[model samples]
Target: MIELNQVSAIQQQTQVFNQVSLKIGYNERVAILGPNGAGKSTLLKLINREIYPVERAGSYLKLFGNETVNLWALRSKIGFVSQDMQEDYTPYTSALDVVTSGFFGSMGTHAHLQPSDDQVALARTLMKQLCMDIDEQRMFQRLSTGQKRRLLLARARVHHPQALILDEPTSGLDMGASLGLLSLMRNFCGEGRAMIITTHHIDEIIPEIDRVILINQGQLIDDGPKNEILTSEKLSDLYQTSLQVSQNDGWYRCWHG
Candidate 1:
């Protein structure tokens, strides 16, 4: 469903992505594991066309086989969810209102934006599926971080996007809230939509995300089955730490002695 060949991202005359190549097939779930400054967020933006890739010979990005296409249409096909999406929302917007706005491709509900009864029903159904019980009247700014995240997921999936791209999904979430978010995503994985997740924490990765790609210093280090790519030495090197990684029943964790 996605392909990037010899892609590089340049910002302020500095390269944040260096000849990176990766492919994600339709309905394939994958996780991108990287440390700080590894350009994970940049990679997501590149896929969504939020930032243009460096235009050069032999470097190209193809979405559904076209190097050039309408970004607005591409956006509807892919649900790009991220921490940055939180900033676009108006502080006083209700959670339901926030979700309904996704249908119109707006950050939040607006004065002229009107949601149909069917769309409102769909949004509420998605909210319940994500186990979000926040009052429809509750201001978005008042909801907890996890609640906001769940509501956003509802917004993204309201249209059954072909793929979901999540960047640092659990960054500021506490243990309980993180688990809740993961659980929601875990269930969504089996519904046949693809997911590309970028995270520093290993445990946030769901087992259904059977493919793992590690990027460091803005380059693709490795890509393969999750079990093969995510290991003690690889992770330790990626993070530049003396760390030990452990896994149980396909769940991974990191520690240091």
Candidate 2:
């Protein structure tokens, strides 16, 4: 559902992507894997229209078959959940208000932009599915890291978007919380929706995500099926170290040899 043709982007006066080209299809599960400052976040911003690529010959970016789209309309088609979003809400914002605000793409509910009863119900249902119903009236800043992440997940899915874009989704969680969030992501994709994940951890690349795109130092390193691209040799070279990679039950892991 996204097409980038020789696209290059710059952020903060630094080039983040150089002649990057790729395609992500509807209902596809893919991961943009890379280390810190590897342009992974920049690429996500490009897709989310938070940044623009440098214009040059034979370079273009398109989303959903069009070069330009209304941001409001696009939000309904692709839900984005990021760490920055979790930090953007006011400390006193209620958990329920955070989810319901998805309808207006706001950080929280305000008197002038309140969510309707149906929207509130939808948000509650999503929170319940994520096992976060108990935190409905709790203040946003009072919850633990995992709870905040799940609340953001509910916020993203409340609109029933066709696709979800998650950035570093499980960065700061205990093992149980991380796995729980990953499981929830898998269930979301099972409902005929697409998922595009950006992460540096191999464990976060769920089994349903068959495609893995490796990026390092603002350049595309590799793009192919998971089995082919996630080999010991490939990962070792990507991370610039001696590493051991293993797979079990379709899950892959890597560590120093």
Residue pairs in candidate 1 whose N, alpha carbon or C atoms collide under 3 angstroms: none
Off by over 4 Å in 2: none
Which candidate gets the maximum lDDT versus the true structure? 2
Q: Which ten residues in a row have the lowest lDDT in candidate 2?
A: 83-92
In model 2, state the lDDT of residue 166: 98
Itemize residue pairs with steric clashes in candidate 2. 1-24
- Compose the digit string of candidate 2's lDDT tens values, residues 153-210: 8988877899999999998889999989999999998898999999989988998999
lDDT of 2 at 248: 93
What stretches of model 1 exceed 4 Å from their correct place?
Answer: none
lDDT of 1 by residue, 118-205 (tens): 9999999998888886688899999988888888888888778888899999978899999988887887887888999999989899
